[model samples]
Target chain A: MISSDVIRGYNDTFLLSLLTKGDSYGYDLSRQIRELTDDAYIIKETTMYSAFARLKKNGYITSYPGTVTQGKKRTYYSITENGRNYLKEKRQEWRITKEVVDKLVGGDNK
Target chain B: MNTIREYIEQMFKGVPVTEETVQLKADILGNLEDKYTALKESGASEHEAIVTVIAEFGDIDELLEEFGVSRVNEQVTKNYETMSESDLRQYIQAKGKMGWNIGLGVLACLTGVAGLLLFLAFQSVLSGALYIGLLFLVGFSVIGIGLFIIEGMKAGELERFSSPYIILPGDKEQFISEQKDYKRSFIFSIVAGVSLCIMSITPILVGALTAVLPILVGVAFSLLLIGVGIIFFTYSGNIWSAYESIKHNGKYVEVIEKETVKHKRNKKVDYVIDEIYWPIIVVIYFVFSFTQGTWAWSWIIFILAGALESTIKSLAGSWDKD
Candidate 1:
C-alpha cells in the first residue's frame, strides 16, 4: 500500500525497467507488477494510464497496436533508447536515495 | 457491459472531447475489456468479473490531477455539491416510484378514454351510456393530470438529479449496476407495452365482427391493456432519463454497507410498495371491467406514495440497529 505520492517520482523508472525487459500491454504490465511486488503494490488503472501518456509524451517509450498471442489488438509499450537511459539514471539515483533514507530512519526503526 | 461503458463515459464527461481523449478512452476500454476477459476465462463469474474490473478502474480525479486539470475548479464553475450516496439512492428509488405513478396515471387516463369509447361504440344497445363515458373521461383525466402534478414535484428532484452533488465511486458503482438491471427491465417493458398496445385494438375488432362479447366490455378490456403497457414504459423509462442527464459516480455505497454490517443492523427493509403502486383504483377497474370511480385507485396509490415517500427515504438513509 505504498502511497502514489511516494512512488510517483519512480513510476517511470518502474515502468521503463519492465518495458526494457520486453514490450507489454497495459493489463499485462499491471499483472506483472502485481506479481513482482507479491501484491504489496497494485497500480490503479488510471495511474498506469497516466504513466503511459507521460512516458510516450517524453519520448521515453513508444506505443503501437500490437497483436498479442491471443490475437487481440493491444496497445503495447516498449522502452526506447532514451527510456533505457532514463531508467539507468533513476536506478543510480534510487541507490543513493535508499541508502540515505535508511541511515536517517536507522537500521530497523520497527 | 453498459454499466462499465457508462461508468467510463461519466468519468470522461465535462472534459473537452478530443481525438487524443478518444484514443485514451479507447485504450482504457481496451485494457478493461482485456482484464475482464482474462478474469472471466480464469473462471470468475460475470458479476464477479464486472465488479473486479470496475472496482479497480481507479479515481478520475487521480487522472485529472496528473494531467493538471483542476476538478475543484470545475465544480466551482458550476454550483455543484458533492452528491452524497444516500442522496443518490433516494433519488433513484424516488425516480422508480415516479415511474409507477406515471404508468398508473396513464393507465387511469386511458381507461377513462376506453370507458367513453365503450359507450360510443355500443351506444345503440346501452341507454345513456354516453354520459357514463363522459364521466369516465373527466374522472380519469383529472386523476391522470393529478398524477402528473404529483410526479412533477417528486421527480422535480430531477433538478437535483444531475446537480447538487458529486457521486463518489462506490455510489456510482451501485447506481451503474442498478441502472444496468433497470435497463434490461426497460427493454422488457418496451416489448410488453408494444404488445399490449396491439392487443388493445384486437378485442374491438373481434367483438364487432362476432358479436360474441359485448362491444362495450371489449373496448374496456382493450384500453386497459394499453394502460398497462404505458405503465411499463414510464416505470423503466425514467431510469434512462436520469442516466442520460446525470454525470456522477460513487464509493460511498461500499462504506455504507460496511457500516451497516459492522453495527449488526436490521438489513432487511422489504417495502410492500404494492400499497403505494397498485392501489384501489386498479382493483376497482379489475372488479367491474370499468368502474365509475377509477380516480380512487391511481390517486390512492399516488397519494400513498407521496405520504410514505418520507418513510422510504428515512429508512434508506438513517435506519440504525433498532
Candidate 2:
C-alpha cells in the first residue's frame, strides 16, 4: 500500500482529474480512483474529503446535491474551467518531479 | 450499515453544525458504506468488512482539523490533564454545594404541598389566627425555594471558574463503573419519588377509618416521605455530581459558554418577563378566586403560565437558530 504522505500533494490533482471527466459523488470518485490505481492506493475517507474541501475552496470544482439513493443524497462534484487549468499545471509539475526522482533513485543499487 | 451510520454520528457528536460540516458527514458516511459493500462483495465476512472499512477510514480528528473544526475531545483531555489539584478540590466543593442547594429547593417545593395539605385538613376546626399561621408556612416554603435557587446559582457561578475533570479514554473501565452507579442511583431516586407520592396519598384512603386518625396518619406519612425522599434525593444528587464531573470537562464548558453568549440577550429578557409574568398570573388567580370564588377554574392560569413559558422558550430557541 502506498503511504499517503508520499502522494499527499497530488491528492487534489487526482480528484480534479476524475471530476474533469464528469460530475461524480464521493463514493463513485473513490471507487474510480481505487480502480485506476489497481488497489495499490486506497485513498482514505479523510484524505478524499479534505481534497474535496480544498478543491471547492479554490473554485477548482463545484458541488450540487445529486439524486437520492437509499434515502441518502450525494453531493456531486464537477470540475470547472479553473480546475482544468490547475490539473494541467499539476501534470506538468509531476512530470518534472518524476523525472528528477527517477534520475536520483531509478538506477540499480550495488 | 446502520451501525456504521450511528458510529459516524457519535464521532461527530460535538462537531459544530454548519452546511459544510453536514455535507462532510454525509460524504464520509457514503464513502464508508461503499467501502464496506465492496469488502463484503470480495468474499470478506461481515465482521471483516466492517473492521477493514473502519480501519481504513482513518482518524476523524484529522478530517475535522482539515475543515478547521476544533477537536472537543483533545481540548477536554488537555484541560483534564492540566487541572490543578486545588482547583479540582474547589470544583468538587462547589459542586457539592450546588447539589445541596438544588436538593433543598426541591424539598422546599415539596414542603409547599405539605403546607397546603395541612391547611386542608385543619381549615374546618382551626381558628382564623391558626389558618393564617398555615398560610405563613406556605409563604415561608416559597421563600425557601427562592433562597435555594439563589444559593444554587451562586454555587454554579463558582463552579464555572474551576476546570472540569473528565474521564480519559484509557479509564474506560472506571467510566463504565461510574455510568452503572449513575443508572442505579437514578432508578433508586425514581422509586423513592414514586413511593413518596403514593404514601402521601395513603392518609386520604384511610380517612374513612377515623377523622382524627386521618390527620394524625397524614402528617406522619408526610414526615416519613420527606425524610426518605430527602435521603434518596441527596444520594442521587451526589451521584450526579460524580457523573457530571467526569463527563463534562472542557467540551461541555465550551458548549455552555457558547450557549450563554448566544442567549445572553434572550436570558435578560426572559428574566424580566418572568418577574412580571408570575406576579400578573398570581394577581389574576387571586382576583378570580376572591371575586368570583372560582378557585377551581382560576388554578388553570398556572397551567397556562407553564404553557406560555415553554412557548416563549421555543420562540427564543428558533430565533437563535435563525
Candidate 3:
C-alpha cells in the first residue's frame, strides 16, 4: 500500500485526472481511485473531501448538486479547463520527481 | 440505516450549519451509505459493516477544519467556561429561589414589625386592644419563621427537578436575533433595579419635611425595595433560562451525561446534609432563645452557624483536593 504522505501532494492530480473522463461524485471518485491503484490505496473520506474543496476553490473543478437517486442527493464535480492544464503539468512534474528519486534509490540498492 | 444516520448527526453536532456544511454532511452520509451497502453485499454482517464503515469514515474535526468552520463545542467552552449544564441550571434556579425566599421572609418579618408598631402607637387607647395587638405581633413572627422554613424545603425539592436537554434549532441569523433580545432584556432589568434603588430612597428625603412621617416613609421604602428586588430577581432568572437554552446548544448530550454520573455519585450524601443543616441551625436558635431567655444574643447563633457551615464546606473541599 502507498503511504498517504508519499502521495499527499498528488491527491489533487488523482482527483482531477478522474474528473477528466466526466463528472463524478465523491464515492464514485474514491472507488475509481482505489481500483486504479489495484486496491492498494484507499483515500480517506476526509482526504477526498478536502481535496474536492481545495480543487473547487482553486477553480480546478466545479461542483453541482446532482439529481437525487433513491432519496440520496450527491454533489458531482467536473474538471475545469484550468484543471486540465494543471493535470498535464502535474503529470510532467511526477515524471521528473519519479525519475530523480528512482535513480538515487536504485543507485543505493545496486 | 437509522443508526448510521444518527451516528452521522452526532458526528456533526458542533458544526455550524451553513449551505456548504449542509452539503458536506449530505455528501458524507451518502458516501457512508455506499460503503455500508458494499460491505453488506460482500457478506459482511450488519454489525460488522457498521463498525467498519464508521472506522473508515475518519475524523470529523479534519473535515470541519478543512471547511473553515469554527466548532460549536469550542465556542461553548469559551463562553460558559467550566460550568456544566446541570451545575449552571442548578446554580441559577437556586439563586432565584434564594432571592424569593429571602424577599418573602423579609416581608413577613416586616409584617410583624408593623403589627408591633401599631400596638405601640395605640398603647394609650385601651389596654385590651394593645394586648391583643401584641399577641398578633407574636403570631405574625411565628408565621414568618414557619414560611421561611417551608420555602427553604421547597427549594431543596426543586434542586432535584431535572431539566430536559434541548438544542437550539435556528441558524446563525436566528441565533443573533435571539441574542439581541436577551441582551436587551438583561439591560432593562439592570436599569430597573438601579432606578428602583434610587427611587426607594426618595421617600426618606420627602419625609425630611415632617417629623413622624420619616418612620412611616422608612417602612414603606423597605417594602418597596423588597418588591422591586423580587421583580428584578425573577426577571434575571428568566434571562438566565433563555441564555442556558441557547448557550449549551449541540453540546448538551455530553454535558448531561457527565452530570448524571456525577449527580448519582454525590446525591445521597449531599441530600442528607442539605436537608438537615438549616433545620438543625433553626432548632439550635429556638432552644437557645427559649432556655436562656437571651433573645438579644441568640440571633448571633444563626450568624455563627452560617460561618461554621461555610468553614466546614471549605475544609471538606480542601480535604478532597489533598
Candidate 4:
C-alpha cells in the first residue's frame, strides 16, 4: 500500500479525476480510488472530504445535494472546467516529479 | 449507524457551531453512513463494518486543523461530558422527585392557610376556633417548610450534573422521541391539575348553596384543591424541563440544526417565567378578588396560569422546530 505521506500531494488530483469521470459522492469516490489503485492506495475519509472542501472552496469542484439511498443523503461532486485544468497541471507535475525522482534513485535500485 | 453518526459528531465536537462546520459534519455523516451500510450488506458484521468505517475516518485532528479549529477552542467541549442514557434517566427521575416535593411543599403551605381559615370561617359554630386556626397554621407551615428544605437538598445534589453534560450522540433521536412521549402525559397532568383546582371551589360553593355545608367552609377546601393540582402539574412539568435542559446542553446543541439551537436558547429565556408565574398569579388573584369580589373563584387562576405556561413551553419549543 502506498504510504499516505507519499500520496498526500496528489490527493486533490485523484479526487478531481474521479469527479471528471462522473458526478460522484465521497464514499463512492474513495472506493473508486482504492479499486483504481489496485489496492495500493485507499484515500483517508478526512483526506477525501478535506480535498472536496478545498476543491469546492477553490471552484475546482462543485457539489450539490444528490440522491438519497438507503436513508442516507449524499452530496455529489462534479469537476468544474477549472478543476479539469488543475487536474491536467497536476498530471504533468506528477510526471516530471516521477521522472526526476526515478532518475535520481533508479541507478541505486538496479 | 449510530456508531457512524457518533464518529462524525465526535470528530466535530469542541469546534464552533457554524454553517460550514455543520455542513462539514453532514457531509461526513452522509458518507460514513453509506459506507457502513454497504459494508453490512456485504456480510460484514455490525462491529466489523463500524470498525472499518471509523478507521477510514482518519484523524479527527487533521480535519480540525484543516478547518483551522485549534486546540484552544476546545474548552467548551472539555466543560461537558456526553450524558449517558442511564444518567439522564436517573437525573430526570431525581428532578421529578424534586419537583413533586417542591410542589407538595407549596401545597402544604396553602393547605395550612386553608386549615387556619377553617377555624375562623366556622368560629360561630365552634369554641376556641381562632386558637386552633393558629395551631393549624404553625403545624402545616412547618411541614411545608420541611419539604422545601429536603427538596432543596436534593436540588443541591443535582446542581453538580446540571450544566456540565450534554446528550450522548446516538441518544438524540431517542431523547426527542421520549420527549414526544412525555408530551401527552404532560398535557394530561396540566389538565388534571386544572380540573382539581376547579374542583376545589365548585363542591363547597354548591354545598353551601344547598345548605349542606356552610359557605365559609368552601374557602378552606379551595386552597386544598389548588395545592393538590399544583403538585400534579408541577411534577410533569419538572420532568419535561429536565428533558428540555438536557436537549439544550451545549454539547447537544453542537450538532443540532442552527435553528434548533436558537429555539432551544430562546426556550431557556422563555422559561424565566417559571420564576415569576406565582407572583403573577398572586397579582391576578388579588385583581380578581377585588374587582369581582370573588376570592373563591380567583385563586384557581394559579393552576390555570401554570397549565398555560407549561403548554406554551411545550408547544413553542416544538413550534420553533417546525
lDDT tens digits, residue span B1-322, model 4: 8877876776676765544556778878877887888888989999999998888888777776666444333654454454566667788899998889989898889888888887887898799999999899989899999998988777887764555354544465677789999999999998898788778878577657777666656767777888898898779989998888777652453543333446546647465765676677778787878799676667657657867977877776677668
Residues B146-240, candidate 2: write the lDDT tens digits. Answer: 86768756865664433433322324344446567668767778588546645655664465456656564465355446545555656566656
- State which candidate, 1 or 4, has the greater lDDT: 4
Q: What's the candidate order when arranged by decreasing DockQ?
A: 3, 2, 4, 1
Q: What is the TM-score of chain B alone in each candidate?
A: 0.51, 0.42, 0.42, 0.63
What TM-score fits each model?
0.41, 0.45, 0.43, 0.50
lDDT tens digits, residues B1-322, model 3? 7788999999887765446777898899999899899889999999999997787677777776666665665444333323333444454566566655655665566566556655555566668766776687688678768867876676666442333332223332354465577676677775775565556555555655567565444544544564555456455645455454445332342354455454443444445556888789879877986698543345456557767876775666556447
**Model 2 alpha-carbon miss at residue B310, Å:** 33
DockQ of 4: 0.42
If you assessed candidate 1 against the hidden native complex, which CAPRI class would it receive? acceptable
- TM-score attained by model 1: 0.41
Ranking by lDDT: 4, 1, 2, 3
* Residue A4 shift from truth in candidate 3, angstroms: 1.9
- TM-score (chain A) of candidate 2? 0.95
lDDT of 1 at B172: 62
Q: Tell me the lDDT of model 3 at A72.
A: 87
Query: Comparing 1 and 2 by TM-score, which wins?
Result: 2
Off by over 4 Å in 1: A1-110, B1-78, B120-126, B163-165, B214-217, B247-322
**Which digits, one per residue and each the tens of the lDDT, describe model 2 over residues A33-106?**
88999989888888888888788879999999998888778899999999999999999999999988888998
* Candidate 3 deviant stretches above 4 angstroms: A108-110, B74-322
